[model samples]
Each structure stands twice: as C-alpha cells, then as structure tokens.
Target chain A: MSAQDTVLVVGAGPAGLSAAATIASMGKKAVIVEKEDVLGGAPIISGYAKLVPSGEWAKDAIGRMVSRVEGDGNVSIHKSTKVTQVAGEAGNFTATLSNGDKLDAGAIVLGTGFTHFDSINKPEWGFGTYEDVLTTTQMEQMVGTGQIRCPSDGRVPERVAILLCVGSRDRQIGREWCSKICCTVSTNLAMEIKEISPSTDVFIYYMDIRTFGLYEDKFYWKSQEEYKTKFVKARIAEVTKSPDGRLLVKGEDTLVKRPIVIPMDLVVHAIGMDPNALNPEIAKTFGIGLEKHGFIDRAEQYTNSQGTTRKGIYVCGSATGPETIDDSIAQGQAAGSRAVADLYGQQKVAS
Target chain B: MAIHEKTLIDPDRILQHDHLVVDGVDVSGSWNTMITPRTLTDYEEHFEEIIQSYSGGENVHRCWQCGSCTNSCTMYAQNVDFNPRYWIYLIRLGLKAELMKDKDIIWQCVSCNKCTNICPKDVRPEGVMKATAHWLEDNGLTPKTLSTHFDEEFTHQCIEFGRIEDTEVMVGFFKRSGQPLVQAWIVEFGKRLTKRLPLGQLAKMGMNVVFRPKTKSWGKTGEVLAEYVKAQKEAAHHG
Candidate 1:
C-alpha cells in the first residue's frame, strides 16, 4: 500500500486492536500508537480480573485480540509513544510522534479509552481512609490473584460491600452520566467472589441496578438466586470504622425506609469511567473538539457514527463516552471502515 | 394535623447519661444524650423462600424493591408505615427481625390491589402483603389479626353452605373473637334493613339466618374445599 493509504490508530486497547485489524483486512497499513508499553489498554494494563458478559479472564480475552493485530503484516505497533502533533487536512496529514518519528497518514482514528474513577476522590466512602476499603480495580486485582483478603491484615473478609456508581450519576461530583457497565460488572464480581469464597457474603449497594437488556437475568438475578449475593437499593452515605474494627457502611435502605449501618469486613467502590486523561491534549493535537464531559465530540452521529468534529478524523470507544469493551471494539471497526472509505473517496477525487 | 408515624430508631438504641465527660471536657446536658450505633446481623437467609411458600406469595422473589407498591398503596395514604415495598425488601434480604417491627400494621392492607396494579416487576406485592401477614401469624411472631379471623369465618361459611350467609359470617367472626354481637352499628344496620325490605324478602332472610341454609347442589364440594384448604395449610407450614 502507498504511504497515503496508511491509517494512524491511537490507543491499542480492545478498540485500537480491532481498528488496526480492520484496517489491515482492508489491504491498508495501520500504524497503532499506544501510550502504554502494553497493547491491550485498560483491561490488560489495569490488571482487570474477568470481563463482564463473558467469564473469560481479561488477559486471555484481550490477549487474543492483541495477538491477532500483532501477527498482521499490514499493522505496525508503536509502544510507549503518542502522537504529539497533527498537521494538514484529513486526506493528507502528517503526524509527529513523541519519539521523533514522523508519519504520513490519510486519516486518524482515536480509540483512547477511559480512566477508572479513583476512589480517592470520594473520601467519604472510606477508600483512602481505611485499608480494607478498595476500588473496583484493586478488588479486581485481588480477585485475579485468587486471594480475596483484607489489604491491611490479609485476613479473609466474611462480608464485602460493593458500592456502585462511585464516580458517575452524582451531580455533587459533576459526573452526571451513568457509567453503564458498572452494575453488570459489580454483579459479575459478586458472583466471582462467591465462587472463590463460598462462605463470604457479598452485598451490592446501588441507587439503581442498570444491568440493562439480557444482562438482567445473567448477572443481577443469577447473582441473587445462585450465588446468594444480596443487592440493597441504597446509595451509601458514609463508610466509617466501627468500634469493633470492621467497616460500617451507613445508608438509608431505600426499600426498607430506614437508615442502616451494616458492618463489613471489606468495602469496594464499583468505580465509574471518566474521560481519558489525554483527551484535551489529544483533541488539540488532532484539532478536534472535546464534548462537555471532556470526551471527544462527535461531528454527526446519524451520518457518520464514528466521525469526530474534524473531517476524516474518527473517534470511537470510551473516548466518546462510558462504553463497554465489546461495544468499544465494534465502534473501533466502524471507525476503521470510515477512515478507509474516506481515504478511498479522496483518492477517487484526485484521479 | 399530620399523622404521627413511629420513628425508625428503637427506644433501646437511645442512650442518655445523667452526667457525662469527654476528652477531659464536661460536655454535659444535651451532649450527654447519644444514639448507640446499631447494626443488623440476624438475617434469616431463607425468609424470602418461606414467604413464597404461602399462597399469593410465589413471586416475592421477583421484587426489585422499586417502591411503586408503597407509593400506590391505599393504606400508605393513611399511614406511611404500612409499606409493602419495605416488607418485601425485608423478606428479600431475610431480615426477619426488621420485618417484625411492622408486624402489628401489616394486616392493615386493604386488599385494594393498587400496589399490584402499579408494580412494573409483576411482583404482585398485594399478595406479598397477605403472605407476609400470614407468615407473621404462622410463625407465632404475631397473634391472628381480626382480618384473618374474618377471612376464616367468611371462607368457612362459603365452603359449608356453598354460598355466603353474611349474618352467619358476622356472628361467627364476633363469637370467635369474643366481641359482643349487639353493637350500636349492627342494631342501626338491622333497623335500616327492616325499614327498606319487603315483608316476604325480610322473612326469607330471617329464615336463612335461623336455619343456616345450605345449597342443595353442594354435595362433595364442601368436603373437597375443606380438604384442599387443609392440604394447602400443611404445605405452607412444612415449606
């Protein structure tokens, strides 16, 4: 393929890998620029345990995608590097990489995914104050290692409380969008915890269980019925250490119409997704726009689902919003096809 | 005046000290009063299943605790404590002790089916209320309510005669509950009935009450109903 046939794909997570694979299948070259040393973005880099909907371990699932793109001859990988600057229009653009490499590309596809909400932001939940309090990422790491124990003493916790929507849907925190996937992920985690330690009781506290569509029976109901995981309809108010050393979760049991303080051995924040940290910089570099939530803004969703505010510049996955892994991958392919279509269309115009 | 509802805090949880000191500072008086931190741990894991064993309670497990039941309940308009949603939550979580707190008022459900009609989960919370009331009585946590007594009396009348004798039911219920039958309201109702009725219809009604009339077509139906009820009661108790 000619140099102008090359596509610059940013972020080598599930979406980036799929985008690169799609570009390669179209007989075009794809230069994947990943900021991290690893390929499979958050799932592999953040050390996620098991993915939702599919019980496949994160390493195994994302690993397969990484290997597929890695084996393709038309795809070139760039690790620990970023696109520093972009110049010229969509049809003929020059991208300057952080490593002093310049690349010519006809189009750009951003698959930069989201960052996990830090539990430290919500100190009232006792994430930073208490040792047993952990974020979903840390809890996923614990589950990954097959040792679900208190971080402070390494003791097996008898009761664990997972608080959902830690960073999302709270106007106080200025994050009003629902983080879509946490409900199903929390339910899946509850089941996994029960499988590893049958004696431990898992309680998920949430304002709403948004395990939408088919996930209702698969995760939410199954967790209750088979695993005996309890789901409480309450947004936890505060988490404090009890006089007896266990963490006390204070909340109004909305259904019971009573304020309850339950002692738990461990408390987990089922954290939400935030816009990628590099979003503003990426928007500036690519000369695109950032949406209100600081995600990459879309140009027109109806005509071009993957189109960014700038022509021939596509955005997909969690970079646009809180997106699931499977949806992100699908969006990645759409973006790749959009880039290919635009590049061919430009070529025809030139001819 | 607005109705005074019971506070969620148990009286035992409130602690007051005549004299108090903290951090070498005498923060007496109002500062001395404290509410002890209370945590619930005595959850019966199979409480939901137990409730489901009763007739009309088979779908208790399906409730997502949406509060629609409580929001639309007829009795809730009168007393907020009469919450079917709250009871369903307690049952789902197996918080038997938490559920016991509302035992006195659970039988107050008016069987309006408003909650059941409005529920999006098809939880049939009206049935859950009935089942919970029955469960409360069956477990001996609560005494048989007046409504339960009346229901039993009405059912007995229906099965024995293959029809209902309203006067017999009222007398049977009053006798079972040890209430005086010659109440002011009953006397007034009898006077109204006497004033409004034709002589022949009035005589027929008086004869039915005196003779305790039975339907001629009611052969094995009464025995079958009684046997079915006995079998259902046994199943509920065992389950």
Candidate 2:
C-alpha cells in the first residue's frame, strides 16, 4: 500500500476507536495500538457506572464503539501493544509497535487519553492508607459491584464524603488546571450512591462546582432538588480516621466561615485527570511539542482543536487535555477527516 | 495580601504602611496590608475539654470546621456574628480571648436546631451553643445570659419536680435574668391570656401550679439523674 493508504491511530480508547472507524468509513486502512489487552480505555478497565448528560450505562456506550471498530474490515486493532518507535515527518511516517510490527501510514493520530491523577501524591487525602478512602476510579469500581460499602469492613456506608479537586487546581502541587469532569463525576457518584441506598447521606466538598455548559449544570441542580444530595462549600483540608475505623473529614465551610468535622464511613477523593505518562515518549518519537502541563499543544487551539504543533500528526481527546468521551469521539472524527484530506491530496498527486 | 484566607488574619496582626515601597514596588493600599506573623502562646488549653464537659460539647473535637452549622444557623441569619462554627473552632484551638469577642451573643442561639439538623458531622451545634453559654457563666467569663438563666432554672425545676412548670420557669427565669415579672409586655400578654381564657380553664391552670405535675414512676430516676448531673459537673469543674 502507498504511504497515503493507511492512517495510524494510537490507543484503543473512545478517541482512537472513533478515529479508526471514521477513517475506515472513508475507504482507508486504519491501524490502532493500545497499551492494554482491552479495547476500551481507562473507563472500560476501571468499569464506569453511568455516562453523564444522557445517563447511559458506560458499559453499553463504550461497547457500541468497540463493536463499530471491530466490525470494520479496514480497521485493525493491536491490543497489548504500544508505539515503541516512529520515524519520518508529517504526511509520511513509519511506526514500530511494541509487538515489533511496523506500519507505513499517511498521517498519525495520538489519541492516547489521560490517566486518573494518582491520589497517593496527595498524602494528606489518605488515599492508599485507609481502606475506605478511595479515588473516583476505585469508587467507580465499587459502584460497579452494586454495593456502597466501606472497603475496610464491607459494611454498608452510612455516610460518604466526596472531596473534589484532589490533585488538580492546586498550586501547591504544581497542577493549576481544572480537571473539568470531577464536579459532574462526583455529583453523579453521590446520586448513584443515594439511589442505591437511600439511607446513605452523600456529601460533596468542593471549592467551586463547575458544571459547565447546559447539560451538566442540570445534573448538579437535580442532585440538590431531586436527589437531595448535599453540596458543602468546603475544600476539605484533611481526612483523619476515627477510633471506630470511620473517616473524619476536616475543612472550614467557606460560606459560614465555620470549621466542620464529620465522621464518614467512606471518603471518596474525586481525583482529577493528569496527562498520560506515554505523552513524553510519544512527543519524543514524533518530534511534537507538549505543553507545560505535559499534554500536546494545539497548532491553533481555536481553529485547529485536533491539529497538533506538528504537521500530518494530529491529536484528539484527553491526549491534548481533559475531555469527555463524547468530545474524544468528536476529536477522533475530526482527526480522521484531517488525515484523510491530507492523504487524498497526496493520492491525486501520485495518480 | 497574598493570603487566600483574609479572615484568618486577625485584627492585631494587621500591619498597614502609610507610604512604603517593597523592592521598588509600591504596596500601599487599603487592601494590600501585610500581616505581622506572631507565634500564638495564649491558647486556652483544656477549652475543648471544658466545653465537652458540658451537655452538648462532646463532638466539638470532631469538628473539622466545615461551617455548615453557621451557614444553616438561624441566629447567624439575624446577625452574622452569631457563628457556631467559629466558636467551635476557637474552642478547639483554645483561643479564649478570641472567643470572648462574641460572648454576649453566644446565648442568642434560637435553639432552632437548624444547625444540628443540617450538620454533616453531627456537631450538634445547638447543644454546643448552650454548652458554650453555660461554660461562659460557669467560668465567670460573663454574667448569666437570659438563656442560661432560663436553662438553669428550668433544669432545677426538672431535677426537683421531674417536669417543668411553665409559670414557675417563667417566674424563676425573669427573676434570675434581672427582668421584672410585671413588665408592660408581660402585663399585656397576661391580660390577653386572661381575657381569652375561661374561668374554669384559669382555675385548672392555677390548681395545676399549686400541685405541680409529677411523673408517677419518676420515684428515684429524678434523684439519680440529679446526682449524675452533679457528678458530671464536678468532673468537668475538676478538669
């Protein structure tokens, strides 16, 4: 096949899957590489409960993307692999995968999505120390099991506190960007816990609730009016343990200028998204620029949201920044279109 | 002020410069005052313990300072100075002098239990308010507030008669609070009560006052409870 025939897509998450499917529909070969043995990304492996806006089951939503890419003959998914090496620039590139397979493609798309911020980094949150102390990923896994219980004793959690911005938006830790999804996720998880067990009092402590846009703001308000979930305006300072294995969260209620201490059965840290670790290696291989925060910078963020600093190579999804699944898919389609357009011009020249 | 918590800078720590430049940058403004950092050594140790010794201050230590109590406080609505969460914080830190700033209004809590009902940490701030008020009087930090006088006199009746006599509680409370029983409002209220009530109902109310209602089975429970209260007070006092 010619260099313009196949479009290389990295990672098999929603972004990569959508990119590959879009390229495949354009009658071009699409190759996808993932670090894990699974097709879906972090959400699939961690096991999410529900998607926001529509509130669809994450399993079914992600399953649809998996099937779309799997059914396409033009698309090839290489699971349990990663891009080990890349050569050439822009329109023509050769990538050597961890599986030792090489591919010559017209354009490259890095859809390597973000990973959850490690809660261990913020020791004050007491993430790994307390069995009942969990991050959103762990809480999602627990929620998948269909029971809200203290991880320490397996007893039902009478009270659960979700603290937002665990690792994000804190100048002390060098992360000044908002993760953008924690507010919605924390709210949804609180609602889910309350729905699963009505007796459970779910409290969310946030510096500010940024349920941006139309849909997410509705869910936040609905949490207060419909679900009766309590939103406390206190960024918790510390999580200490009680004598009875319960967690004590300490923070001042900024609204009342009062200090509060409450014992909780479980403490869920709504950790934010950090740039994927593979970003540095990928940037090194492809000769692209990464922002100070480690995510790839857009060539022109306003006009070319998916276009990276390097020509022919593009980026979509959380590879560039914190993005929802829907946004990742949209970026995937845009990257596919950009790749196909570049390849089409080259194909005409070759003919 | 580079400080995130502006309120944390107490009044004494404020340092205002009339006309000063720091590293060639003029930092003279109404809002740009600096704080003089000072190590605190005047914390009232055992303040939390003493408050906890009272009826409702048991969970004061559990307070992480979320301010939910003050946010939902009924008294705070009337006057922002009526802050339960702030007092709880001061009690925990043993900031006795800082707490004394709001001594008079500490007893202004309406006992609405809004703070307690909405407290995420179960701080039971209504109880804390009473406890703090009692603490203030017990320590002679302030004179007995009307609420404290009312509570003590009411509790005395309960300890003695097993139940509260509304009339006796009112009379005892007014006398202890230094308010005359026959005030203009009280006489008007009494006139309204007497004008609206039938003679038979009035007679029954008078008879009930003469022979106070006693719990038939509260034979030794009252004495036991009174003794228990006394022991608790002694323990707290010793602390």
Q: What is the lDDT of every predicted structure here?
A: 0.87, 0.82
Runs with alpha carbons beyond 4 Å of true place in candidate 1: A346-351, B1-58, B71-80, B94-98, B109-127, B144-234
How much does each candidate deviate at the interface, measured as C-alpha RMSD after superposition?
2.9, 11.7
- List candidate 2 segments past 4 Å from native: A346-351, B1-239
Query: Which candidate gets the maximum TM-score versus the true structure?
Result: 1
Ten residues in a row with the worst lDDT in model 1 chain A?
A342-351
Expressed as tens digits, the lDDT of each residue in A308-345 for candidate 1 is 88887998899999999999999999999989887787
Q: How far in Å is the alpha carbon of B155 misplaced in model 2?
A: 29
Cα RMSD, each candidate: 7.8, 12.9
Model 2 chain A lowest lDDT segment of ten: A342-351
